[model samples]
Target chain A: MFDDRSPIYQQIANGIKDEVLSGTLKEDEQIMSTNQYAAFYRINPATAAKGFAQLVDEGVLYKKRGIGMFVSPDARGRLRAQRRERFFADVVDPMLTEARMVGVGVDEIVAYLKDGAR
Target chain B: MISLRDLTVRYGDTVAVDGITLDLEPNKIYGLLGRNGSGKTSLLSVLASYRRPCAGTVTIDGVDPFENAALMRATAFVRDSLDVTDQDRIAKVLDFAGRLRPTWDAGYAEHLADVFELDRRRRVSALSRGQRSSLGVVLGLAARAPLTILDEVYLGMDAGARAAFYRELLADYLAHPRTIILSTHLIEEVAGLFEQVIVIDRGRLLLHEDTDTFRARGVAVTGPAAAVEAFAAGRTVLGEQSLGGVRQVTLYGALADHEAEAARTAGLTLAPVGVQDLFVHLTAVGDTARTEALR
Candidate 1:
């Protein structure tokens, strides 16, 4: 289910982040153990552990010592803030660039967006 | 840790494994890769102590493994041509392994046999190719040795059977961590399971590094022929192909961020190359000519 564009660990971290943002994983919810994640994804447990470690480092997830991992209380808000910081450059800028290339004016795009909003 | 210092293996005049030095830390899965006749088996043989190194030395935790009772007993090496008696039933073969290997788990072995749907009453000779491979998986995983070397033990397994084997292997390994070395041609299928990858070519060490690092090494740049050529200039090109006005070149190194941005501005698409493609290009015959032509 993963791709070669990036390391599998990065993908795993991003996948968990996406789940958090989408509310599939609620804040303070207990998540699967690294072993379970590795088994489900058919990946090395070490790789899965690396991904979890990254999330822990980023404050997106927290460990319970002898227990399991839980989503950070502020993880969703923090992730949303991070994605908002890059939304224009990563998503809107490219859309605008493609629109400019195809001779689509900003007014037309605005009109379409307004129509969708209505 | 397992250390090999300038190890070599030879058969008569033919050198199967050239002088190579490597250190394997305990409790990690290593994928051993090589083309046929490239000495992968010989290297594994030396590691498993099935055959002594022609030169150099092999030590496990500061002691030689060859003929060492304790060390050898703690290492399980299962190959395609199993070392079991053809006339023995599957149950008997497993019983023999349990008796010899101190780490063998009979309960786990029985579970694996059920997972593979193997009939324990059937003789080894009567089993199908796929079944034999499954039996090998059972023996290798259930042994749970400190060092387990599976040299193409998946030879005759079908895709489904192989999937089960991979799952079982990973699950068991998680439960009981050990040093696992798998030598196989199925790079893409098994690449994810390897913490580190060791590739050998022509009886010599090609590359050994973290699996993620190795995966990041190969990049495929695709775009207009001239643009692709310009971007590929001064880079190590592993392989390339052209169709009409579009050209794609597989490169042997990761691109710098600025370089990637420049390629994007120039309308070139950079794609990651899979481990299998990288392995094929890296070990392809007559590599110099292909690389030289690009330069």
Candidate 2:
């Protein structure tokens, strides 16, 4: 099921990326065709196709002439690299901002992280 | 493509469709949305060639559709009512449609009947409201017309039946692509099935755009009253609510990346508004008054 908070196509693309990153979808693994995805999700085929097209544009998936879409060989690695690039700004920075607002010092956050590591 | 130019429909002294012009591409599902008395049915009737527009013109692939036998055969307009003789059995009605519709697939119709659990022996007058609706679904989907318009064909179906209808519709559409226009009051339930959304209000075209674009147009910003208010200051606020120190303002525009970042940095949480919620806000009584005033 998809939430309405963002474009469904974006969500679809993110979902496939997550699968690829988690190794659930291996390199060259053929995924559901856009029509199959549409029927499975009870969505318009055009919307589902748009999501698949976005993934292809980002090099996360590849087309196979007349067959179907397959996961790119470097999809997981590229996705991981992309996430790493945004980790601090998208995740840690927001967390640190919240921490600052709550009057928690950076040392306290560092100590908590150290404790969790153990 | 289907084109309508300044189309108008009137019944007696009342103008049902007023100078509405729109272009719909082929082979896409369009959600036709409108409040009660918004002329959605009137517009669809004209498109289906059930009636002529009082003014202006309607063309399908560069040909006038009104009373054009070939075009009529290519279009299927299934109304909320079954539009069959009460004395006829369900099987007989479908047989009639198959004889008239060049694209009608008897096998698909039978399959859809089974999916909807329709009894072929039942007379039209004997069927329940839900059963009648299911029959309409069978007719609309099985016809496989290039242009299929269903006008709130889910009027009395229960939740399970409606779910089945949606699933079957998507599956069949995938297998055999065609142009579909569904007019429904159940916006949230069927919004996902639409590639494009057309909204009409008070016999006027309100908006027509890709469904995703329409979905992204409304954003709800929630936070402290001051922060929320500040973020919504120059925006078109669709609706708002406040509880204790928290305020949520629903805005009618897509927020730019930096603007969304600014809201988040100001501690405001941005949420996407559902299509139903956006439609409600856009067609709300007060908003309609404001729209009329602006015009």
Candidate 3:
């Protein structure tokens, strides 16, 4: 199911990226056709197609003429690399900001993380 | 393409659909929304050529649809009121549509009947409201007309049945592309299916744009009353509510990326309003439309 947080097509594109990251959709694996995707998600075919188009543009997926879309051979690695690059800014920075706002010291946070690792 | 030139429809002293001009492209699903007595049905009736407009024109593929046998054959308008006899069976009703519709697919009709679990031998009079609605869905989808309009045919269907209908409709539409217009009050349920949406209020065109744009045009900013008011100042406030110093104001415009970031920093929650909430605020009684009219 989709939410109104962002455009449905963007959500669809992100969903495919997540699948690639999670290894649920293997590299070079044939993915659902836009029509099938649209029906499965109960969204407009055009919207689903737009999402696939976005993935293709991002080099995350490739299309086989007269066939369907497949995950790019480097899709998983590429996604992981991209997420890694943004991890500090998108994930870590936000957490640090929230922690600072709550007056949680970095030392205490590190201790808790080390304890959880045990 | 279908074009409407200053179309107007009247019944006695009641002006159902006031003068309105618009164009609807082919092979796209359009969601039409309007409040009760806001001329949604009358406008659809004219577009479907079920009734002649008192003034102006409606052209289908650059030709008049009224009394044009060729054009009529290519258009299917199915509403909740089943056009079959109460004493007749469901099979009889579908047979009549198949004979009349030039593009009718009997196989698909039968398939849809199975999907809806419709009893073909059951009399129309004995069918429940939901069953009758299912029959309407069969007729509309199986007709496969170039111009198919379904006017709230899911009136009596349960949530599961409605979900099935949406699935069937999207699948069939992908298989056979055509111009389809759906008029419904279930904005949240099916808004995603529409490529474009047309909203009318008080017999006037309120808005017609891509569904995505229509939804993105509004944002709900919620926070402390003073900050919310400051953020909403100089913006079109479509609706607002306040509870215990927390205020939420729905603004009718886009929120730029920087502005959204600023709002976040300012501790304001900038949320996107769903199509249904937007529609309610757009056409609710004594809402923006009435205020505009009064001004």
Candidate 4:
């Protein structure tokens, strides 16, 4: 289900990017048509089209003339690179801040990471 | 596009719709929200040409819709009260619609009947409440009129049937784009489908804007009563309540990211208000007075 905090189109675009990053949607693979996505999610077709349009703008998806949209050839790699750039700020920093608030030391986290690595 | 200028409707001494003006763009889904006796049905009836306004004008495509055959042919309104007669079978009713409705699609109607599990052979009187609502949906969608209005057509449907109807409605809408207006109290259930929303109260227009902006205006902040009150001081407070020592204030305004972050750091929890919650609070009697006073 989509959240109400941000525009639904942005959420749709992010959802597709997540799929690409997870290898569920491969490069050059045709994705569900806007109509199909709208029907499946019970959202307005215009909203879904907006999301797809955003992805197209970002080079994450490409239109096939009269056919439909396909994941761009470098979509996964590009998505991975973008997420990697934000991971520290968006994920790790928050984790570290929460850990600090809970009295979890950096050495404790390092030890836990080392044990999990084995 | 559709426009209503100072439109008003009255029944005996009661004013069902007060003077109001609104313009709706074409091919977009609109959600019409209101409390009971708030003139929602009356307003829609005027738009669909089911009733003539006592004053002002209702126009579709720049011409008066009242008794205008061409415009009437292009508008379809399905009210909670089924328009079909009790003597007619479901198939016979659809057949009648196919003959009268300019854009009626019999094939699609039949497909919808199958999906809704409606018995075409059954008499209108013999069907259950939910089945009748399903039949109403089928007629509305298959008509494919340029302007389609459904006033709480999901009145008796269960959750599953309602979900099915939403899916079919959105699909058909995408396949053939047209204007749609859905009037319902079930805001959260169908808010995602709306492009814009129009809310009315006591026969007067209260709010009309894109759904996102309307939703963003409502937010809830909860924490110590003193902090909650302080943070909500200058904002438009829709509603508020307290439990034990914790208090929550529902506000209607844009809260900047830094402001929200400050609230969080101050040990307050900020949450976005759902469409239903906002609708209820906005239309509630006491809150309406406060809102009007503020305006």
Candidate achieving the largest TM-score: 1
Residue pairs in clash, model 3:
none
Better of 1 and 2 by TM-score: 1
The iRMS of the candidates, in order, is: 1.1, 1.0, 1.4, 1.7
- Candidate RMSDs in Å, in order, are 2.2, 2.0, 2.2, 2.3
Candidate DockQ values, in order, are: 0.74, 0.78, 0.62, 0.57
| Second chain TM-score, each model | 0.94, 0.94, 0.94, 0.95
lDDT of each: 0.91, 0.91, 0.89, 0.90
Per-residue lDDT of model 2, residues B1-295, tens digit only: 9999999999999999999999999999999999888999999999998899999999998999888998998889999876899999999999999998889999999999998899999999999999999999999999999899999999889999999999988888888899999998788888889999998888999889988899898988899999998888867777899999999988987888999989989999988898889988888874666446323
Off by over 4 Å in 2: A103-108, B223-234, B243-247, B265-267, B292-295
Predicted candidate 3 versus true structure: per-residue lDDT over B162-232, tens digit per residue = 98999999999999989999998888899889989998887878788888778787799999999998888
Give lDDT tens digits, candidate 1, residues B233-267.
99888889999999999998788899999999999
Which residue runs of candidate 3 sit more than 4 Å off their true CA positions? B288-295
- As for lDDT, the candidate ahead, 1 or 4, is 1
Ranking by lDDT: 1, 2, 4, 3
| Count of backbone collisions within predicted model 1 | 0
In model 1, the runs with Cα more than 4 Å from the true position are B288-295
Worst 10 residues of 3 chain B by lDDT: B286-295
DockQ, candidate 3, vs. native dimer: 0.62
Q: Candidate 4, residues A14-69: lDDT per residue as tens digits?
A: 99999999999989999999888988888887788989999999999999999999
